[model samples]
Each structure stands twice: as C-alpha cells, then as structure tokens.
Target: MSNLPKTMKALVAYGPGDYRLETEHPVPVCGPDDIIIKTEGCGVCVSDVKCYHGAGRYWGSETEKAWVEPPFIPGHEFLGFVAEIGENVKGFEIGDRITADQILPCGECRFCKSGRYWMCQPHKMFGYQNTNDGGMAEYVRYPKTAVISRVPKELPREKALLIEPYACSKHAVDRAGVTNEDILVIAGAGTLGLGMITYARMKNPAKLVVVDMIDERLEKAKDFGADIVINPSKEDAIAKIMELTDGYGCDIYIEATGHPSSVKQGLAMVRKLGTFVEFGVFAQETSVDWSVIGDGKELNVLGSHISPYCYPFVIEHMTDGSLKTDGLIKRTFPIEKWEEAFEYASGKYGDFKVAITFD
Candidate 1:
C-alpha cells in the first residue's frame, strides 16, 4: 500500500461520445474481502464500442433499465496482476496473474445456489452495472462477490486478454452439442466466432462452415478449423449452406454475429430439430416471424449468456495450446491513445480485436 500510487490514469464513461481519460483518477481502495489489481491490459469489446457510440440497447428506453450506469469504467475483457489482497482474502498471492468472469454472481441467488452462477438472478455484470467498476483503468478493484480466477503466467498476453470472450464462446459451442455427423454453421469470423470454431473443431463436426463479409476473416476461419468458408457479400450464404447440406439444412447453427440479419439467416439455415445457439449481443431488438421457430422449423433455439464454469477449461487449454489464437488481436495502444485504439477497433483497422495496454 505504501509503494502504490495515490492517483492513476483512468478511462471514465459519462455518456455517448463522452469517455474521458482522467489523469488523476483516485486508486480504488481494497475492502476486507475485495481485491485490487494493476491492470495490464483490457480488450475493447463490440458492446463497449456500441455503448460509446450511443447504441440504443445500452442507453435504454422507458421500458428497460439502462444497461450502462455511466460515470463508470467500461471494460470486461481484461487481465491484471494482483497488486493488493484484502486482509480477509485467500487463495491469491501479491503478484499472481489473474482475470475474472465478466459476471459477479450473488452467492445466494437461485442460479448461484444451483451451480448455474452465470445466470445469477441479479445479473450484475462487470463494465455494465454501477456496482462493478470495470478494468478500463490503470488499477481496478474486484468486489467481494467477484468470481475471480488465476490466469496461467505462461499464457501469452494475446490469449490472456481474450479469456473472457473465449470463455463465452466456449459456452456457446458447448450448447450446440455438435456431433461428428452434424454439419455446423458458425456465422461471423471475428473474435467470438473464431473461438467457437476452435472449440467446435474439438467436437469433430463433419463439416464446419463459416460465414462472414471479410475475406481475410474467412481465410482465418479456415486456418482455425473450418472445413468451408462462406462470404455472404460475394454469394448467397444461406443458399450455399442449403446446397452443402443437400437441402436438409445444417444440423447446428451458432449465431455469433451481432447483426439482426444473422438471426434471420440462422433460422433459415438450420434444419428441423437442429440446435440454434444465439450468443451475440445486438444493438437493438431483432424481429422475425414467430412461426419459423415453432411451426415452420420446430428448431431447438438456445440462448447463451456470459461464460460460467469455463475459466478453468479456457486457462488449461490456452496454456496447453489446444485453443489457437495466433494473430487474433490485431493492434494495441497505450492507455493515453484509447480514442485511436477504439477507432481502429471499430473496423477501420480490420475486423480483428484491438486492446489498450497499461504500463
């Protein structure tokens, strides 16, 4: 405590287009059961970008509570080193590398009591709620209720930075329940979709088809484990999928693209009784014909939220090199250049991931 700085640089969100980098933000204090860490880096997520640019879902309407409680930090995909452990905290050291689940579940909730903590009734998420101060700053505080996990020091910065998204992606892939006989379609080849490809590959699906607009991401999809890649910008992706499956439709469709079109597209590309996993966050509500899900296709539509019971698997496979993330993160900038980093992240510098690094 004596050696740590009193004030540190931080990125604070006020409203859309009003995020400021404050040079004198006070260091977060550690409570008896809380943990404080020196943030090494934090990845900019699509939701973060959407919120910064005034997405309606984050802003909220008269109907729903605001997803973003402003005047707070806004980063969930982050990695840090334990700088200060609370007096009552255990199972962590002063210098342990660590990351946490995006969710901070209340232990007494029905979901938490049933071991499905990710779906905790309170639904408190880091970077969104007022209670959780996210890691878009030099130093971040993890509350007493945070579900923290130690990251393997041997893991590369690129992979460690992706643990949160990768964990959610793994959860979506697991929900798909792909089999060797199943033909799987994973739409979107960005950060989350690529993680789905890596994990879906382990399932040994017969043919893994990837759909995206960018040719480069489609190429990267092939490298990850896709048996075939589809560029909807160049051709009719849904029709091509139909032909591939001999008009029977794919056995599993995982929608990782946040676009509303992807939801409708998955509904058309999957066969009756096939599994449909929806994991992406959309900026607005998606409307579709109700019959397509029940009467028309009778599809098994499943929705996946943030990762639960997956950090251990992610850390182990990432350390063993089973989950590949070579060349996933495209660029990084110092905390001072956050605006530039986010601009490049919003597709100016390709559709890959961009991160903000802290010294």
Candidate 2:
C-alpha cells in the first residue's frame, strides 16, 4: 500500500466551464469495503458536454433544483485496472480489469430492494456527486454498494470503455420490443443511437433506419447495421421514413439525439399504435404536444434511463467480436490534453468519439 503514490492528476469541477486539472490531487484510499482502480481510460460522453455547459438537468433550473452535486469529477463512461482491493472485497484481485454501472443504488432503497436499482430513489450517479468521484481522475474508488462487473481481457481497452454506453443502448433497444416484422427508425447517429442500431439489428427488424444531420455519422451508421440513413438537413427525415414504410411510418422510433427537433420528428415518423422510446439527455426542455400520442396514434411512449442489467449481455458480444467499433472512438488524447479531448468530443473536430487516457 505504501508503494502507491499519495497524489495524482485529476479534473475537478467547480461550475459551468470551470473544470480544472489538478496535478497534485490526492490519490483515493481503499476503504475496508471498497476498492481503488488506476483508471486506464475514460470516454467523453455528450452528457459530460451538457454538464460542462451547465444544462438545466446537470445544473439547476429555476423550477427544478440541480441534479448534479457540483465540484465532482464528471466522466461516467470509464473503466480501469484494479490497483488495490479491500480486504472485504471478494472475487477481485489487484490486476483485474473491471468497471461498474454509473448508478450507485443504496441497496436498501425500495427500488434497489425490489431489483429495479436503476431507478434508485437517491439517484446517486457517479461523476455527479462528491460521494462518488468518477474516472476523470488518475484513480477512482468503487464503494462497497457498487454493482461491479469484469471486463474481459480479450477486448481492447477502447472497446471495453464502451461497456457503459452500450449497456444503456442495449436496454433502450430492449424497451422498443422490436420484432422481425417491424420497421425501426432510430433518431441520431451518435454513440447511443449507433448502439441502438447495433442491438436493434440483432432483433432482425424489417428495416433499420437512422436519422442524423451529419453525413459522417450516417456513413458509420451503415457499418453499425442501419439499413438506410437519412440526413434531415438535406431531405425530410419523417417523409423519408414514411416512404420507406409505405406511408405507414416506422413501427418503432427511438430518439437518441438530445436535439429538440429529433423529438418532434420521431412523433411524426412513428406509425399509430407504434412503440416510441426516448433515451436522449437534452440540454434544454423539449416541449412536444401529447395530443398526437393519445387521440391520434395511441403510441406506447417509453422512457429509458441508465443501463440496468445489460452489462453481461453486452460484454459477451464485445468479447466475441460480434459488435463493430470501426469509426466509433476514432479519437483519443492523453490526460494532459483533456481540454482538447473535450472540445473534440463536443463536435469541434468532427471526431466520432473522444476518450482521455491515463497511464
């Protein structure tokens, strides 16, 4: 234990646009029921960007209080190698690669007690609160209550870092309940949308369509299993989906883009009595009329939060090479260049994905 460094580099948050990189941040100590990891890498997700910009969800709105606990490290899409294990920790060793779901249920909460821990009342997500410092630092501690899982050594660290997002993506697809006879249209070509495409393709939907404004993302969506890609900036996306479905509209529409337009477009592109899943994290409120949902379509509108029990299923596919990761994660930066990494992820450099690495 004395061999570990006392202090390390970390990105600490104070407020909007106030993330500071500290070189002498104290390295966390392992509690009796907790373990510490030497972070290998952490993915820069759009949620991190939204938080950086002080989105009402992360920061607070006048009506609804803030969700973020502020002044906490904020990278949830992350993984690392276990450097120190608590004496009470079982089934884990010092050199094992592992990761945990972002949601840290209190174990005694009603939802956690009933096995629906993803909706834990406290909603103590990592990277948001001080109690759970995220992987934005050189080292991170996993609490005794954390739901941990092993990342197979067979998968590359880059791909392994995707376990968290892919887990959420898999859960969204599962919510859609797609069938071979259904036409599924996913809005957005970002990581989560593409992830939805990957898992939805496995469901063998009649036609898997992706809608996005970016040409580059649409191109990669093809490789990820989108049967057709529509760029809304050029052509009418809702009209295109209707045309592909013979004017009936897609049987299922999943919104993964945080943009407000994606919400309205999905409502119009989904057929009557269709299933619509909303999985995006919007920086602003997306106000849409519900009349079309009740009086006109009677659609099954569903909301998906963080990943629940999909880690194992996603890990198996990732290890077996069934999942594709070509254009995704096309960019990386050393922790020293985290500012650039964040800017690149905010679509400044047109990179598909951005990750900050640690040694």
- What number of backbone clashes does candidate 2 have, counting pairs of residues 3 or more apart or in separate chains? 0
What Cα-based lDDT does every candidate model obtain? 0.88, 0.88
lDDT by residue for model 1 (1-359), tens? 44579999988989989999999988988888988899999999888888898777777767766777878888999989999988999898889998999998899988899999898987877887556878888988898888888898888887789899889999999888889999999999998999999988899999999999899999999999999999988999989988988898999999998889999999999998888999888767899997989999898999999888898898889889889888988688898998987888787678488899887
Once fitted onto the true fold, the runs of candidate 2 whose alpha carbons sit more than 4 angstroms away are: none
lDDT of 1 at 152: 84
TM-score of model number 1? 0.96
Q: Against the true structure, whose TM-score is highest?
A: 2
- In model 1, the worst 10-residue window by lDDT is 56-65
lDDT of 1: 0.88
| TM-score of every model versus the real structure | 0.96, 0.97
Worst lDDT window (10 residues) for model 2? 321-330
TM-score of model 2 vs. true structure: 0.97
Taking the tens digit of each residue's C-alpha lDDT, what string does model 2 give over 47-148?
888789788877888877898886788898889889888889899988898899999899998999999999999999889997888989999999998988
